[model samples]
Target: MNIIVISSPQQELNEASIIGALFEHGLEVFHLRKPTYSIYDTEALIQAIEPKFRDRVVLHHHYALAEKYNLRGIHFTGHYVKSHSDQLTNWYDKAKQQAMTVSGSKHQLKELETLEVPYNYVFLSPVFDSISKAGYKSNFADLKSIEKYKSATQLIALGGISLDKIDQVKRMGFDGAAVLGTVWEKPAQAIAVFMELKAAWEKKDQIF
Candidate 1:
């Protein structure tokens, strides 16, 4: 399973430093998803990351920065998908022309059935209880049903993912897992937590 780290919605102390360390420690993909940041703020944040590792970063908004910074891709949120339904086809074509990878988030399995464009991957959240959101519990009860949708596109497990649950995610056939609260809860120890998760994921891969 691929281990992805998402930037905290709100900036944290030494945020850029934490992200830089994560890249050095083998973080392959870093999702920069600051909802409130203006385009300039987002540009500044991306600029702060080391240039060599900037290609591994994915943006949630300010997609125009993808080409400017040579980012890995762009992620569309559920709201963006719904609100821009009419413009998605044109947007997808343009993103493809730029050689950018495309991904999106879907809160429900039903949403996957209606996806018009093929994405590199899509995040299906709350697979387990949410670590960051209080009382946002997992609604996943039938893993078999999730497997059926694998033919449509790669599905990534999000929400409440932690070291202990990495195996569960793989067993359920998720292409990857996204980490948020577990890493941000202790920013100083985030790299350690990620290493542990990465080690466990590798072990599981070896077993299978």
Candidate 2:
């Protein structure tokens, strides 16, 4: 599974250092998910890292940043999809014209089931309770139900993902996993977590 890290500084993490670690660990897909941050803060972040990762990083909930920073694409939230689905479709169509992929979030299997449009991937969350978003729960048993939609959509599991859960996610047949707290707690430790997850995934693949 491909690993994606959400951008945030956990209690001990320095944002820049963590981001740098992600790159070092071969994490190519990053979601700049600072929803509560001001534009200036977000802009500064984009200015700092976007240049180095021009084609690899993805900004979440910020379409303007993508156009301004030469990012790969934007990861839309459920609110964005529901509120501006049509408008975003045009954006995606235009992006596709340029060979870019558009991704989104789907909290429930029904959300994934209801989509009549195209989204490159949908991040389904709470595969387990995560430190980043506490109280959220992941229904792992529902994976079998979600697999039915694989033909029409690519699912990326999010929320509380860590090295240990790699096998469970793979068995569920997810296309990828997006990590936040697991790597954000210590930027320097990010690569280690990533390496372990990769190694675990490799082992799982060998077993299956």
Candidate 3:
């Protein structure tokens, strides 16, 4: 299992309330995906958080903060990944040298194929349904086809991954999961939900 990453809310962009809850439940990596926030706002939040988690959490779209804060790594959205291909020339080799991990999002087979961005992992989405972004659901069968690209990219399933679908998701062979509404809507219940999903995955392992 890679990790269960919590995507920061665009509306609130409040990292303080989430850090304590996520840390208590042993969440190591976080993706601050608020595209609306200015880099300054993201930095202020990271400044407040990095001291507590050390090198565990990461901020997305806040590349300037990466060096100053010593974040885990950077996460690139599909837009960033696609548009910055030329910029990422020799990135794979460089990333290996720097000991840094990169991640990006993919919604189409074409996007997945073009994901030669030298990132450590990839997130394929709406395996079921999404709350934040409606109509983001991809065909389940097509989503499963993503496994063929696993050799090139570590695929973390996102969107609609819930307690009930954990077993099926594991069977689909995703590297990990990235959750948003399921965790953010009720921060206090984060641990319980994490436990339930973990249990489902664990139980599935037993039967196999």
Please give the range of 10 consecutive residues that has the lowest summed lDDT in model 2. Answer: 9-18
| Candidate 1 backbone collisions, by pair | none
- Taken over the whole model, the C-alpha lDDT of each candidate is 0.87, 0.74, 0.67
Candidate 2 residues 101-172, lDDT tens each? Answer: 688887777677676468778898777777676677775544654567686568898888888888888878
**In terms of TM-score, which candidate is stronger, 1 or 2?**
1
Ranking by TM-score: 1, 2, 3
Query: What's the residue-level lDDT of 176 in candidate 3?
Result: 81
Give the TM-scores of the predictions, in the order they appear.
Answer: 0.94, 0.87, 0.84
Which order, best to worst by lDDT?
Answer: 1, 2, 3
Model 2, residue 132: distance off in Å is 1.3
- Return the top candidate by lDDT: 1
How far residue 143's Cα lies from its native spot in candidate 3, in Å, is: 4.8
Better of 2 and 3 by lDDT: 2
Once superposed on the true structure, which residue ranges of model 3 sit more than 4 Å away at CA? 11-14, 50-52, 90-98, 141-146, 202-204
**What is the C-alpha lDDT profile of model 3 across 64-167, one tens digit per residue?**
57656666777777677668767555544544455557777777556666656656777777677885666776546545445566765688888887777776
